[model samples]
Target: MTDATAIDTTGYLALVRRKRLYGTLLLAVFAALMASGFYVADDRNAGGFFDGLHRIFDFPAEIFSEAFQNWRNLPGLFLKFIPSLIETLNIAAVSTLFGALLAMAMALLSTRGLALWPRLTPLFRRMMDVMRAVPEIVIALVLIFLLGGGPVPAMIAIAFHTTGALGKLFSEVAENADTKPVEGLASVGGNWVQRMWFGVLPQVAPNWSSYALLRFEINIRASAILGFVGSGGIGYDLKTALQWGQGKYDQVVAIFALLFLTIMIVDHFSDRARARLVKGGRRA
Candidate 1:
């Protein structure tokens, strides 16, 4: 019995050491992979990291210097770009509204037990996956080529991406919902729409609204980027100003300030709104 106990202890210690050694080897391999990837990326880059590190602030310095020299024009520049800024905001808002509505329908259709057609749930899920996988830029570029440059293309592109993203999140939330309400409604001969509208929507509305608001924030940035690549909004103006170089640096500064302020405002409001939504949801 003493010898058996000794053998068991020795085996246990060996197993533990083997596991530790394997874990260490895995970590070492991961580190090596990361190091190699960074080296490869650096090699392929047009400018080396260390080479550009010091000059990183050169552009910002130039913009600030020019803006300071022409500080009086900042307000005028802001007003000039206000129309473009509105276009950007409109694109984001319209896309979010349409996308959230579409996502709500898709979410209900894809969710188990809530689905009107359970067999087609997989189909709707795959459709959302495909929509999500296709980046906003790709759709924007394609639509731009086909329809010409405008906010319409950007709006559609962002909406498509938002639908897929929100659909998945909304469906996940629906899955956790209490089916008792739905069951009770159905017992009273409620149709699918009635069951969902009267039952699921109330439970999921706050979370859905929160997600939509967050998507609105992301869509705003995406719309601006799309505008730069296509045409329309402050991004296009920024791109144009950038092309003019030193002489138009003031305009560039103004654009940056506007973009920064807009983002800050949106982020602040969205944060507060989300907090309120979560608190309200918990209370309900």
Candidate 2:
């Protein structure tokens, strides 16, 4: 190779080494901070799990014993909460659908070279950052206060959070997309929407869909938690059952079973869907 080519390769290697060093330093700093935080939390009695390590299973034992005694009531209790379970499912499904759609639009808008109004990209980026920075429960509580407690609040909160998360992921995937198609479309006088729909979206669809599917599974759990915190859905029923204590423990068990089964099914479905999307699928 020429001396000039040798100098260029040396510069590239130096840049790579610098990046690796920075990454290592950042990771070391993060680990140090985490270690210090844990120590401080333990000192302040904020580490309850560590303090109560021996008795961790005490509550579970009591719950299981009570649930066992009322085994016959489990089926009835489970059936009773089916409607509430359905409500939770609806909340998750609706939020995911809307969130995915919003995320797609935002992803296209925020991504470099893909955005119509590229100058507004930074504004959209900050907007997504704010959305994800605020906790979903915080949003849910605000909505609950304004609109009253119900599935609507949980759905909106989850959707808002999902949009931020999925938007971030989708934008990253879009960034690595082949820009040639976009340029081609633009050269042919295709509008921004046409270029995105025909050029950008087709390339990124599978990855985006995979991320959305995983987010949907996560939102199911979020919906249940939000429902318990606010109102409406099986989580609210679970809360009520727990509040009633011993006599209603069986209902709690039923709700737990339903939640577990539902999560399991969704997880399996998401895994299969992702495999099909990214791997050309396995033959059954």
Candidate 3:
């Protein structure tokens, strides 16, 4: 028995050492890959990191100097851009709303056991993957050409991406849901819609809402970028101001300030809302 125990202990120690060696090797490989990638990226970049690092604050300094000198114009500039800011916010809000609605439906349809048509689940899942794979810029640019540049194009582009993204998240959450409620509802002759509505929705609502809110924050940034591409938002104004150069720096600063403030406010509210939702979900 003593000899057997000694053999087992030796084998266990050997296994542990092997695992540790493998883990260390993996970590070393990952570090080497990261270092190589960064070196390649730096070489390919327009401005090398070391060269740009020293001047990193130059642009910000110039902009702030001008903005500070023209502090009196800040309020007027803010007022001037309020409408565009509103348009940007509207684009994000509408896209998020539509996306969340579409996501909810697609998620339900694609989820296993919860799907109304189990065979078609793969089709729906593939559709979402395609949607998510396409970048908003590509869609927005295409829509801009077809639709002639407006908030609508940006809205649709963001919504399209959001739908796929939120759908995947929603489906994953729904997959882990307790199916007892769904079975209970179905046992009473509930239809597909009824089963999902009474069974899946309640369980997934909080998580779904949290994901949607996070998507909204991302969509806001996307909408702003789309605006730069001519989708008509604060980004368009910023682009125009940037083109004018020197004297227009103040306007650029104003737009930057507004965009920054808007992002901060939205981020704060969404963070709190998500926290509340998650907490409420756990309690339920």
Candidate 4:
């Protein structure tokens, strides 16, 4: 009945009082502690409590200089580089294919009602959780030790890790799929396998291929690194070149540029393929 627009002075004052003024002081203290910690951890600093500003633009001039020197030595460089590149490609291709198969199996298991063991959703999810918790590099390190440092260990590592990762992602995609076709298949007395084959696979195949191609690009990089552990690839050569020093640095840069360009080309082609797939899907 009074002024409806009037503020509730008591409530407003109580709310203002409840605001924690100490929050800003606490935040400042936390920020100061973090800054001090970062300063202490910085390598560029002298024996002071804080490190000096880091030289962020320290480029390796030696690498460029060596690369220029080796520009005329292309034939000799190719002899050392081509085998490693092929090995890397082989690792990537085999691992990606294996991972795709494993991902498909795991994805089928993850769909809520699609699997035979519908009650084992928690178990399946937990298993996937465990698999995905471990990083691919860590897995590769372990496998290298267990299986003896070779391409086999690297390929297995890539396969298992990719399976876990792609499986989880593919499972989520499968879950989000439109249920109408699945339900239709069920109404026609279709079994789980039939529904999966005729309904889910058709819809998700393009997305699955897109993801696989992306993974392949990542695999190429991983394969290169696997050589660090004696898994055999361009990374091994790169490591050798680094250790050799001076003359090899240029060659290393050249080889690295080639590897990077290869990945870029793969990415470009994959993007085009994905676009074409999407367009074709839409037209259909």
Go through the candidates in order and give each one's C-alpha lDDT.
0.94, 0.91, 0.95, 0.80
> What is the C-alpha lDDT profile of model 2 across 1-284, one tens digit per residue?
69999999999999999999999999999999999997888788855756689888887888889999989988888889899999999999999999999999999999998898999999999988988787889999999999999899999999999999999999999999999999999999999999999999989989999998999899999999998896589989888889999877788888999999999999998999998987756465
Candidate 4 lDDT by residue in tens digits, 1-284:
24543557666776776665567678899999998887666644554432222433223566766667767776677776888888888999899999998888788887786665788767777777777777667878888788877788889888887888888888887887888898999999998889889978998888888788888988888888888767888888888888887667777786777788788898898888878765675455
- TM-score each candidate: 0.93, 0.84, 0.92, 0.80
Ranking 2 against 3 by TM-score, winner: 3
Sorted by lDDT (best first), the order is 3, 1, 2, 4
lDDT of 3 by residue, 53-85 (tens): 999899989988998999999999999999999
Which ranges in model 1 have alpha carbons more than 4 Å from their true place? 1-16, 281-284
Question: Global CA lDDT of candidate 1, please?
Answer: 0.94
In angstroms, the error of model 4 at 213 is: 2.0
TM-score of 4: 0.80
Ranked candidates (TM-score, high to low): 1, 3, 2, 4
Model 4 residue-pair collision total? 2
Candidate 2's clash total is 0
Going through the candidates in the order shown, the clash numbers are: 0, 0, 0, 2
Candidate 1 structure quality by residue, lDDT tens digits, 31-74 = 99999999999999999989999999999999999999999999
- C-alpha displacement of 57 in model 1, angstroms? 0.8
Candidate with best TM-score = 1
After TM-score superposition, the amount by which residue 225's alpha carbon in candidate 4 deviates from its true location, in angstroms, is: 1.7
